[model samples]
Target: MSMTLTDDGQTFSAGRWPLSALSVASAVLIFAVMQGIVLSLTGGVFDYPLDDPYIHLALAEVIAQDQYGVNLGEAASPGSSALFPFLLVPFAGTEFHRYLPLIWSGVGLIFAAWLWGRLLVEAGYGRAEWRWLGLAAAVLGPIAVMMPMVAFVGMEHSLHAAATLALLLGLHRHFSDNGGVGLILAGAFFGAAFRIEGLAPGLIAACALFLTGSRRNGLATAAATLLPILMFMGFLVSQGLDPLPSSVQTKLSMTDPGDEPGFIQLRLAILLVNLREPGGMFVAVLALASFLMWRATPLKGTRWGVLVLVIGAAAAAHLLAGQIGWLNRYEHYILVMTAAGFLVLLPKATQGAVTPLAIGGVAALILGGALAYRLPMHFFELPPSARAIHTQQGQMARFVKDYLQTDVAVNDLGYVAWQNDNYVLDLWGLASAEAREIRTTAPVPGWTGDLTAKYDVPVALVYDHWFEDGIGADWVKVGEFQLTVPGGFLGGYVVSFYATSPDTVAMLTGALEAWIPTLLPHSRFVWAEGMEP
Candidate 1:
């Protein structure tokens, strides 16, 4: 039940194995249980809760074939994470590709849990009752930060969380113990590679080092952080694409373009909007509590203060420039880093006291759990969420691949593109720079028609309301796939099928008629008005 420092004085031994190894085992066990629940609900089909993973898989498939985009031979930067698709390249076109993201997620969970355990040990939690607390913290920390949900998302976020934790852990070690500079550099590099937003934490930590008089380490951290991102941008530029991914550009364009506010104003506006949400409020509280803990600590002038500063600055930056809730991802890295920073700092701040820090830690956990009140709900909803994606996007992919057997246009491009080799014209602009350019530059009524015609796409499956002004007057609404269950994480409950031209209507209608009988449970295909097979 107690942990003791190993001979190297770097990690703690909790029996025969290191505490980190035990933590990894605990995390894997919890993940397996969650997966079992989801599998049971979904009839043993291993599917991500969101359709987004498939987009990465689609890009990976093409990347494996010496291409870089979802559409074969077309060099496009659609994924937000430049490194994730390449990570999946080895598994691409293999039977194991679909499970690769989940596998990586499990690995990330294991790594994060291991890092959390090591961090607790490094923070002086290696004796008596504190040791038990450290063990509990290692097991519960990931859950508190919603790592299970991040894993279920099956995206780059889990690794992003782990890398961010590594960065913080490195910062702690370098400043407190005058070591771990290598960790700092590796964390900075891989963190940015996983998610571009990761640079925020790395830059903040680097600035902290510079201010703390570790000028050489500061510069190294900065260089390591920027190198991968710059390389990715250069690669995109070389591919004749924008320096940023299309997904990033599209998200930026969607955020109040009409106002055209100044940078400061825009960031402040975004921060305000974030603070209005429950999660945002929780982050604000966490930051405030972390600052107070730093102030209360005798070592405020030391590395502990640096950790608090970095965590606070990173959380603020995320609120200002990053997204918060897209299936409880996006902000997950910040949550994990912040929570881990708090745990590591608590023992030091409390000066090894039992009652006060325990009370404070419990309070913080309760507060976070309260705000994440939806965590349990989301856990149970995972199966239904997967079902939603499967019944909606999965069926869309099915209809396109099995029924139409030709190129198609779609607003949501993940499942359809991943399931088929046919050309998929992304109207929402995540995958196609041309589609993004068209949507952002020329927001007109008939632009979809022109774009589909340019790609020679015969049909489209789209959420009709999403394109209020661009569905095209000439495009026929041939049919729709309506999910009977709750939409959960879907963009819409009903996905409308459209024929790009009048000549394609009969073909689309017949395809829909044939596909109707094959519809999954809790989903129905309905013909559009005045249209029947």
Candidate 2:
């Protein structure tokens, strides 16, 4: 459970940490406990804003099948490498997929707690302030601690949070000491952050060099930090893998429009808005105190360098808004920095007086108490469960895997693709690079594929909504299932179904109702054929 790493980078000290062990273990435990509580509160498989528990299930399935970078031939896309997919594959294969999201959530929370605690201690929080330090860290990292459970259901938010904190901590140490392996480790964290999101941390690193007094140290730090990324890219290239045209970039180019305010205003606005959010008010108060602190201290030596990096990074990210549409997730590390930014200013703000710290601590506790009161009591909104939707999709998948025994092509693939072993047309990612290509010179059409390939897909799981609106008509309806019974959302969970048999013009008028006792009664479904046929 515990280990140590020594100066020579070789032996363990008589008895100590192997560097960040306490942080890692604490993170894991915190993540697990939080996950258990949340899952117990909400039944298993809650998928509201994101109705794709199956996406993760699919990723784990791919890894389970022992296929690396297996695209499942759905859409013009490849699998993502955000890490959680690979991490959860075994669990999914073993029917433990329901708990995968919670596992990552736990990991994120624990790491966040550990990082905040250790970083605060290292930043010079006195023993008397440890309780305040813990409270402030939680308040500052509210998003880091909880959002990973809600918004980051499938992605690697926890790892990203941990890495971002590590990067900042390493950067802080680099500014303090300025030589040796710590600098290299700082660079390594930078590299890890780069792999997470290219623009934010990269911009921060670049700006740090420009703003810091040690041009050589800043530049050295930037170079060393980027080394891991460069090496990783090089390895990919060597393996004949084109890391560019990457899933992250391709997805960004497609779904998101690249237009937003400059980084400085945007970053500032984010803090304000986060503060305004029911869950973010405590963070907002801490942010105000932090800003006050930064104003008092400004920047001295390495601290000044770190400030320069923060400002520069924020500025550059804003200026390049035309190219890299600002997705808030990309800037999650800002949570940790804002906390550090406040500390850097603390000494000057207090001016050797204990009063400012005391007032600030009390204010943080009050704000945090208010936020904690509101989130669960008033905003106790939970998403619908995937388990409810899974039955019919699972039944259909079982039919295909057993009786039908043929490949399937779905237009709007979600959990359906993951439950079955059939091939998918697209999996909610790069496969539909239509959105991305349309914003470019050539203006390409998305999903430009030959559907009538050698492999015959006997079952087509199409959703009528894609065609009914006439927004997209690439598919032909072969069959349908309709429900005549008056149906309404039952406790925020809607259950409805439609079935289309192969070559059937649609099922009987009330086939949906007829199969109600048989099928899982999905929120929506359809049976259809591809346009190429």
lDDT of 1: 0.80
Instruction: Specify the highest-lDDT model's number.
Output: 1
Q: Model 1 over residues 142-248: C-alpha lDDT tens digits?
A: 66677766787889988988898888878877766647798888899999999999899988888988888989999999998999899999988988888999999
| Collision count for each candidate, in order | 0, 17
C-alpha local distance difference test of each model = 0.80, 0.43
Sequence-dependent TM-score of model 1: 0.94
What lDDT does candidate 2 reach at residue 512? 27
lDDT of 2 by residue, 1-533 (tens): 32222212332222222223443454454334444544443355343223344555665676576553324433232434334556677665455675575565556556655665555444444224333443444343343334333333444554565555665656555554533335334534542543445335544654565565556655665665566556555644554555543455554444333355565665555544444443344334445555444554433332543544463454334323312212233334443445444553453344424465745653554355345434343123222222333333444444445544445555434455565665654412333344334323333232212331323343455444432342122334434433222322112222122222334213322332343345533424343343111
